[model samples]
Target chain A: MVGFEVDAVLGDPAIRIVVCCGSGGVGKTTTAAALALRAAEQHGRRTVVLTIDPARRLAQSLGLTELDNTPRQVKDAPLYAMQLDMKRTFDEVVLTHTAPERAKEIFANPFYQAMSSTFAGTQEYMAMEKLGQLRAADEWDLIVVDTPPSRSALDFLDAPARLGRFLDGKMLRLLSGTARAGGRSMFNLVTASFGAFSKAVQKILGAQLLTDLSGFVSALDSMFGGFRERAEHTYRVLQDPQTAFVLVAAPEPDAVREAAYFASRLEEGRMPLAGLVLNRVHTSAVPELDAESSAAAAARLGEEGDTARVLRVHELLMRQVVRETEVAAHFTDRFPLVPVARVPAQPTDVHDIAGLRAIGDAF
Target chain B: MSWPARLHVVTGKGGVGKTTVAAALALALAAGGNRVLLVEVEGRQGLAQLFDLEPLPYAERRLGDIDDDLRLLAVDPEEALLEYLDLFYKMGRAGRVLRKLGAIDFATTIAPGLRDILLTGKVKEATTRTDEAGRRLYHAVVLDAPPTGRIGRFLNVTAEAARLAKLGPIKSQSEGVAALLRSPMTSVHLVTLLEEMPVQETTDALAELTALHIPVGKIIVNAARPPLLSSRVTQAELKRGLAEAGLPTDRRTVTGLQSEAHAHLARQELEQQLRAELAHLKRPTVELPLLSDGVDLPGLQHLAALLRPR
Candidate 1:
């Protein structure tokens, strides 16, 4: 298999944005940070990494004890790192697009508070929103985005549309009393089912939640149009020719399966997929010594000696290498054309600039 | 003897095999001819994948031909919400109408914690359910919950909802779920690998669960690798042993093998360090070995046997 040209993607001036996406705990954040650091340090490009990892692993890797919503420079390098503050980003969007008083009212609404902080898709949406903000700023020559650790890697792609549908959903408008004033036929349908519908909703969510939701919807009604439009605009930016998508995964069954799914989803969405970063892949030092032969040799000699133990260790390594290869082949065989850059499993966790640089060197 | 708890909530960092652990635990509980329910709430269809079945519906289905005692349920929040309405308010027709109008999506998705509330609500229902003969419907229920990063918030969402609802069935239901989650009958087990990041996340999750007053179960260490070589094996000894084994004694092969052995030793040392860290938490810990062949039905059974109560 041809190796993925990591440096080529990072150095390509035409590709302004690179999005690293995969399932949770697949080293997506590490890949993004490493790519950004390499672009800034090796390729001599100004780079910024926007990470949505709630654990803040990127901050520790960048040697910053803390990362705020805004980008901070890492050491003397041209690279900048920031963790997405989903709630604050949502609030900023509201505050920027709405009047101060209305923004305050929306913030005060319990539904708005919940939606801003704990909503299912809010992190993905805010990550996109922050990406749009960073790209519009145009301070960095390159932007590397680490998507949210969603259950499905495709959630980042689906979030904008989901949020748009929810904000423009007829049920929300009806609950907020906007549909009653918009169309006569719609108003008739609303009136016909409004009593029963609201009764069910109220009964399930209770009257307080319904009231708060209605208040939240009405307060943010004016900004809804902007929200959807911006979401659409950022989504378009993602689809632009200048953007590149890198699918990161470990040499595990689930992660590789997700990467395959995400690659196909990107193809369906007309997004440019650069390649796959197969992280934490196990490799055998002596590939010539097969697991079967090693195990047989170990058994021929008794298990008591150091030579037998060494043979056993070699056997274990060979087996792990075979399993990882088979697991990775599951993806590569399906998408044979997808370039792969396999990073050998590290002996310890990456927690500093040197460790990230080593990863970059591997890439 | 019975298991330690009737409801086992298995959570871990993503890719740490929580779903697999939960399934194994369910199978272990069912080994004694006890009826067990394994539930998945992430909508990831992980149980379906683990069991090699089609995507599971909101209904409970038998796992396989091995036994009739074990069943699986992939709880969908939307379905749970509609079911809740039908059960509590008898709003069957209204629920369908709401579904068409997108109110169901709004109620389940837009509300911050309502989706989680609905999910845990259903789990609580299964935990406390009784049959016509006044016998427990399930002897045990194992929940494959969200990862540790969100486990605290996911389990405690009912408290937040209770504060928000303030009235009606939602409020009472939230309070009921909260009580069930905090009760002694429930135990939240955290699964982790012997790696820095996962162990760190496990420790943090333990603190959060403790602070939330949720019952903490055993710390389950998954994918633990056994030490293959003695730590005292020296580089010179390894080289001599390779020559004695009739393997290549060339410098290149010797260098490669030595480097590999060094990495293996370093990883083993790190694992030992993490084991100590987890031991300091003072929770009963269980270790599951790494399955080199990847997880399958037989492998799951192997794991289940290890999980069986002694």
Candidate 2:
């Protein structure tokens, strides 16, 4: 297995986009920020980091009061940052792709509002949308995008198709027809065509709201292909050689499986995986003190003494290193082709610019 | 935890041990002769993998034994949707018709409010069910729910009810689910580890769940590293021992000792911060020590013992 050289990956002139992906709580946002900072400061590449949820860590590091859709320049660093606002991104898409009246209709529609914000795959879709926008703008030399640590790594990959299917579904066609028909079509014509299906929907949503939903759909009809095409474009950008997917995972069994799952999923999609970032790896300073030796030494010191207590702590530390190494070995053994970079757990979480820079230096 | 709520929704940041906590909680409840049903709503089949049992399908299957008192179910979204349709709408033969029309996929995957409703709806159904003799079919139902990021929306389906399915059985069902979620009968427990992100997410989840009127229960801090040092051993003493260990201390060996001491101090420092952050969440918190070799079937049983009431 090749050992991952973070410097080489960050400094590569051919690489422009780095995507940090993994299951949740893997320090993905931090990894993305660190890589972006490294690429900008060390590699001298102008960088912009795209994150779904930065919380306070990114804000503090970037020296921003808050993040919005527009990429804000990070203070005293050669990097830019923004948190994805899914609804705003969706609204921008609708406003840009459709007429003023239709945009108003969509923005006002409750169903549209719900879908744009809380729908299962909307954030994933908007993340891709925003990525496409950032790349198309060509404003930054390196764009680091952080995807949602979804329940499945495939959720973001599958969103475009699911969205296309929903938009192009027969229900939308029926709803749009009824809404557009505006009571002009014969009642029997509607009954004969939609009968049970419309009946089920009408029973739940009532006539007025269903009409509103269908109106929203028909208004969005002109932009359906545009959205799908953009998804394809983003999908292509991800597949490009200039792009690298780094899977960040903790030194835990579940996190290891998650990383492996993501690796294979990326492979299936033909997306280029740069390597695996094994975060929070427990490494020993005293690797020479074998566990057996440490335990024996502690036993000799007696259990109650201060020195014995130190050995006790030493044994715990030894056990942690042993476990973390096995977790790393599990990854290397499974996907030996993927290079692994280990980041030893820090004394504190990364909350500021220097912390992110330290992470950059760690790998 | 005596007579823990009938429906326990275990959720946390992605890496937190939600599945382990759910399985352990089920075992803990079942130890008292309660017929507990553990459901994996994320569909990871984590239960089957954790217990080393056969993979659970959409239907409930006996998972080895939590003393014959626990059953496992991986709530497949599609199957759950279909069953909901059959039970509520009595769609019967029309289910085939609906699937042929791609309605099922649209509902489960494409529809925003509908998707969460379907997932939460299944848990509600399982928890509220009864047998022919009028006794509860399952004494407790534990759901390894969606992570903290999505739990609020998953439980708060009322928005969808009010907007999409405004005035029908679906709306009422959504309201009923929300009510069940808010009631004392249900507990939305946030699971986390002694780490920043997980603790941060747990705190955030607690606020969100409380804001949504969902009963926020215990904060489970999982995978904590047990302190191996005696209380009296100071950091300096540990470093001193590392410096003077009974051996020919070479440069590499000294560096190793230094690294161990630094890691130990860092860990202890971080743990203090994480514990303080968790305490600020204002919920009763239970800490589960990090198990060696990573949590397995036996480890899960031991974890269950931890969750058990004294």
Candidate 3:
């Protein structure tokens, strides 16, 4: 039931972290960018925005030709931006936790490469890892993060535990343990050693590939616990009062439903939710008139004239306005205390700093 | 020639109405009197909620009046794997043992490709299933697949399953699923909105599908609004129209009309620009109206009728 006071959150010295989360195509990234820009330009806080979107629209709008893992300061604003390179972040985590030789061996593993880049939930996990790193650096007064665009991103709360379980799974330990024992006794050791499960795995994966996989798993097993520990620390940080979660949604049924779904999730997780921001709301010019009256008036005005056409256009607008009101009311009724800030749909997509500035003004 | 494929994988950026579009397509295809099974793999229960029906179980259930031929199934990876094991290996009790031993979790997580294989294998099985007369059980199977972000890997089952399990029924099953997916009998439709981010993601999905060698189907644009006024509305014309309407001379009413006219003009421009950009993708396209009553059964039927042409 928190009132989403964007400027108030930005102005508070104690509130250092802002997380913008929503389903994809709901302008979550744009909201994060605008939040960062507003915090930096108006509130005079040094800010950085991290986004997981592969699209370089954020980079292009920030006037940068390209964005890599490293944060770069924007041209005129007091803001910095960076795109999370999942594979690079995963590699860095591995390299930091493992020996140089072992890390190199792990890096060359095909399975490792694939998991680091394209695994279902890896981007969200890496994004959380990056958030922890940025917070630890203590450079920016305000940090805004745009969560990855996936329903799975909501399961980020379980990432650390899941990764931990996968890393500590018996198969890895058994494979690595046997790989170090010796290749000659590998089959005998696997069969006499673990159980039918390991035997099935070995027979299925083939001897040569099993050897390569075991070598890879064995080399990287030491740092297994660190990944989970860091993720857990960040998960705790997300629950801190200093962190504000802003749920953004467009004025559509699906998007609104998703926003509510995410809000409830944040509540369950005990994350500090600032409030909901309803983006691209349609506010009609003729607010007092009902849709029925407007339609009737347009019909009575006749259909063949320019005036009639204009009235017909007005009727359409009125209907949209009425529809938007009903949609808005549903959210308000469901989440009574969740204060909403409505931003009108822009005539065009926000491309440059001016567009961001205009949005800042609108809100 | 109606829809062109027995299997249609409906995918797009998140929040772009993939569920609605897929449901509409399923209804449309079934309206042709073909038996259709619409399967969802993400475990979203999106179909149930979209239709306001009971939450679908992993097992296929017949949705009520849509058609006897049109059925919906929510496929969970875990259930799909167990079914796959039981079906392929006839390992009913052994499948329970694999679950207890965490073999299922290992395959699903450590070897993520198997998850996709399980999902696609179910779809392939449905499409390839035949009755005594050799007529396919489901003439059409519409898959509400994963989003564009993961679809490339999701459909590249052959390569991924090969990377992990080199031999056994798993490898052979994955190859079979891959063959169906890569064949002319499969088509993937990408749903998107006429906005910059969605259009960008649509293009990215198209490029990835091209690289994956999957044929692109129609581009379905959801929640599209009709243009009220052309972008070229002149200020003088607007003023004259307001005067000719003869409804109001009050300052407030006049101002309201003017603002409404301006907003409509702006929207028309934005719509044109975004749609023009999306058209650059060069795929056959379908546009569905943004319903005023919001998402409902009647609205879904409206969308279904709209998708009938495609």
Candidate 4:
């Protein structure tokens, strides 16, 4: 509908993955859908947009009442989409890498379960796992993912490596008796902390906590490399050009600052960034008959208090614009090469596919 | 009823409806005739939205029947820094320089885990604030804290920083803040959904908070759905309801059958979650009804009523 030409991020036909990442409430899901929609409609590729946001923001955008771990086709767009159930994805990863008995053993472990579901990088790691699965799919030509709002959006790429580092780190190895120093244990102090911690943990969790932790850690020790290689593979796929990363943000100060931080983080990591999609930006192109002018006109038309009302309205709208401008500047100032497209704030929530298409038009 | 616990720190992961709970609690407290201050840090400005007011700033704005008794303050980090410096170090010139340099914002944003210290510090100030006549103006202060994931690290950092900054004003203040935080008088309320991730995170958050000696008051499970499936036939009927609603189907995805299967399994999972959560948390567990529409003011007020003394 517009004169803009869409650029292929990965650039290689063989590369069919796109990762949409940024801070919270930045329309990451909308951007991912637009990209997936474009890939399907323009390139004639069957695509899927996956998200890890528990808010179901993308699911709402795509007009899905509720999305599970499984991808579903929506409105004949020749695409499939889903919000990755993090716990489900983690379970799938465990099942794929470990035996059923081993998986059960791992799941039964309290420490392992806690780390899998509630730790800082769990969502990021699960997202990477979901991406890997989608990339390996035979049916879809393109797979688009929307990552979480944490600073660790890309950290899942390093999760396996980080896990390996964790295992190799003094803490775990010290527990494993692998870091033998002078044939004496170096984990006495840590062990004591762990003992006090375990007792506290046991008292809190009803005395079976350490048993679960030991078993879980043991299972993790056995199947560590497979998980690492999977993570490393996802990282490589993400770094590839065919897998373009679009950073989404709103024109709000906090949202834009987060986007700026994310962009810089990506730049440091040398990730392939496609562009920035600044959603819900308040426009300055409204007629001169805005709150300020309208209020003045109202007062002049014999309503004394009307002018104050109009000025107050204008002040509010103006603040909105200023916030947007601040956020926009933050993005453009940092990433000069990356293009930014603005989607004006809608009066209502984008809960339908038509609304999603309207957002998609901005890209 | 036992002094209504001096301060209630309602915290959870972001977007778990902390501000909503805080608003409701204030209204409930006021209904029970206690002057309260609903405080929010991290500058989310969510309280104004909950109260259906225009976006609020650092100033305490009075609203509703709760007003005259209850006051709401969304603590601005910059204002908190000025107050802190003036009250503690008495550094008038240095404060201006720090404000000009955006050092206050920098401390809130860039540094590792300092935002928590600032946030906790602000909440502490609110809970401890007295009137000009040296009377305790607020019977209670409800803090809408950061989400559960960060709360543990947030509390731990101040205690950690106290050791690092030992002998300075920061050390003394950090230790003071830590004592209040760990005290039984302050209770942390975790808001969660009935879903897997939230339930699991609640458990983890509770464990972490307990380890830090922070007392948990209650668990407010938001957006909890009633059971849709009863008997096998009812489950089948539920599946039909979903299928008629325009869910897509393909050879691989038999939308009717597969979704029902997933939904059925999900129901069982939610049941397990309920059992686990109730077993774990000894405090009063309040189940908030899922709203058919989005949660706006009326919905939050209804929720607040549920938490009130009947």
What ranking emerges by DockQ with the best candidate at the front? 1, 2, 3, 4
User: Where is model 1 more than 4 Å wrong at Cα?
Assistant: A54-58, A61-67, B232-236
Q: Mark the regions of model 4 whose C-alpha exceeds 4 Å error after superposition.
A: A1-15, A54-68, A149-164, A180-208, A284-295, A302-319, B1-5, B8-144, B147-310
| Residue pairs whose backbone atoms clash in candidate 2 | A285-B256, A285-B259, A285-B260, A286-B256, A286-B257
How do the residues A31-64 of candidate 2 rate in per-residue lDDT, one tens digit apiece? 9999999998999998899888875756666755
- The top-ranked prediction according to DockQ is 1
Model 4: how far residue B63 lies from native, Å: 25
Candidate 3 chain A has its poorest 10 consecutive residues by lDDT at A185-194
| Cα lDDT of model 4 by residue, A1-363, tens digit | 111234445234675777777654455666677777777666777778886663444465464656478888877566777877878778887888777988888787646555665554567778888878877876677788877656333454444455545533444443444445523455554554444434432432233433554455567665666776777787787777766777777665456656776777777777877677777676543323244543444344443232223233333445456555765786687667777767776644455566666666655
CA RMSD, predictions in order: 1.5, 3.4, 3.6, 15.8
Report clash pairs, candidate 4.
A10-A241, A10-A242, B12-B147, B12-B148, B13-B147, B13-B148
Evaluated on chain B only, candidate 3 has a TM-score of: 0.92
Query: How many collisions per candidate?
Result: 0, 5, 0, 6
Worst 10 residues of 2 chain A by lDDT: A178-187
Number of clashes found in candidate 1: 0
Q: By TM-score, how accurate is candidate 1?
A: 0.98
Q: What does the lDDT come to for candidate 1? A: 0.87
How would you order the candidates by lDDT, starting with the best? Answer: 1, 2, 3, 4
Report lDDT per candidate: 0.87, 0.79, 0.78, 0.62
For residues B26-82, write the lDDT of model 2, one tens digit per residue: 888878677888888777778877887777888887766545578888887778777
Superposed Cα deviation of residue B2, candidate 4 (Å): 18
